[model samples]
Target: MLEIENLHVTVDGKEILKGLSLKLNVGEVHAIMGPNGSGKSTLSYALAGRDGYEVTQGTMRFDGEDLRAMAPEARAAMGVFLAFQYPVEIPGVVTMNFLRTALNAQARARGEKEIDAAQFLKAARAAAKTLNISEEMLRRALNVGFSGGEKKRLEALQMAILKPRLAILDETDSGLDIDALKLVADGVNALRSPERAMLVITHYQRLLDYIVPDHVHILADGRIVKSGGAGLARELEAKGYDAVIRSAA
Candidate 1:
């Protein structure tokens, strides 16, 4: 569903992603395992068309459409979702309201009818329950004063409600305890569908143990150095990033 070719990205005039290429098909979950500065997050931001992460060279296409030409909101309306590594706190916006607004905005942008309050409430409550989010949490301002686990769970809840065609999870496992990680991973795994694809960017194989990506890639030096099946993640776990990249080299 997504194809990138020799993508070179520059952030603030410094090149971070150099000649990177990847392809993800529908119904596949791909895991990108890389050390710090490997351009994992850069890939996600570039795919999502985040401002300031300029694509200096190469092309990114989603479902045969030129992704670079679309704005972030347009991309969201086109079913691209990026779950941030650090979810920001939005004070004074109730979590439920924020989800409803975002969902309806995407619907409107896609020329679909808006979801009424009762329908949205039912969907949100069901998703929140699956993610173990409490009713009180939904009533509170989005991510305000929440713990790391709470913030991550909220991100998962957003993903569940958004139901993007392509989900790019940028280090969603960071700062999450084992229990919290399991909850978040379960929520992610539940959304896996034949019509959906997920790009899971993470530092550790622990997340992969739960998500179980169809393909595992080792990204290093702003490029993907090695790509393999799920076993590659376990190998990386045993040998470490330096050793794995060295072996790939």
Candidate 2:
């Protein structure tokens, strides 16, 4: 569903991603594991079209269209969702209102009729219940006064509501407890289907235990150093990234 070819990204005139390339197919889950400063987050920001992360070279195609040519909102309308590592709090923006607006925005872009208030509420409530989130939480401002786990849950809630074709999770497991991690994984697993793809970026293998990936890729110094099956994650945990980096060198 997504193809990134020779991607090189730069921020503040400093290149971070050095010719990174990877391909993801619908219904597949790929996990990217790397140490700090290995350009994992940079790849996610680049793919999501975040500002200031300049694409020095290479191309990205999503569902047969050039992603680089599209705006961030345009990409979202075309079914790309990014669950951030840290969700920001938006004061005065009610959670339900923000979610409804976002949902309708995509629906409108797709030429589909917008969901009515009643229908949207029903779906949102159902999704929130699945994620163990209370309706009261949904009524509050987005992420305002929420704990780390709460913020992550809210992100999952958004993903569940939107159901984007390709979900790029940038360290969703970071700062999450075991229960919260399970909740996040369950939310992701619930969205898995033959028409959706997921790229999970994480530093540790713990998260992989919950949302097992079909493929595990070890990223180092801005490039994928190794690609293997799920077992690779366990091996990396056991042997550490130094071994992988040494092998790549």
Candidate 3:
């Protein structure tokens, strides 16, 4: 579970998120819909404790702990995962190697012993298969020369393997074709459980068709202006964000 209270964030001295607040409970799925420059991505980065994005005024709590005081790695170790919109390409970093390192790092932080190579391989292989990613793909450099869809699938692979308690997907549906989108959505759906929560950030309702959220939120000008049920998503898609914004206004 996670809670944000009056989250006001700034980047390069420009305010982006102003008095934004939301609460998510375990096993619940929420979708954040907004127009461009609505500070959706900023909220994700700020919640993830990414550097450079200053949290001028606000408090973010993850499972009752103050997330603002913790480092990014600490947040990740505490079961917070952020699926980035643009997955960076890291040449010379084999996908498997990077994954193992990340998994081991989190495990160690939690005082858990690192998994053996054989066990890691078995789990990774199974997860990759579920995501329709081949071992050959995992053997290559991380995100290097991979298609947009491929990168998104790789993100899902990581998510499945990590099994974070709270996952924040920042526009994972962007730039994905129908097939790729479905694959990613399936992966997300497969990971949904009573112990986890998800915040899906997207502009279109098409992705919601696959991952139907329990709640829908409309964010505009750095604040959540509207909150509704699944029907709100359909209404927004049918009429566009202008209607929602005007109605909220």
Any idea what lDDT model 3 has?
A: 0.95
Report every candidate's CA lDDT. Answer: 0.95, 0.94, 0.95
Which regions in candidate 1 have their CA more than 4 angstroms from the true location?
none
TM-score of 1: 0.98
- Per-prediction TM-score, please? 0.98, 0.98, 0.99
Tens-place lDDT digits, model 1, residues 171-198: 9999999999999999999999999999
lDDT of 1 at 187: 93
lDDT of 3 by residue, 161-205 (tens): 888999999999999999999999999999999999999999999
Clashing pairs in 2: none
Task: Give residue 167's lDDT in candidate 3 (0 to 100).
Answer: 94
Pairs in clash, predicted candidate 1: none
User: Residue 166 CA error for candidate 1 (Å)?
Assistant: 0.3
Model 2: lDDT to the true structure: 0.94
RMSD of each: 0.7, 0.7, 0.6
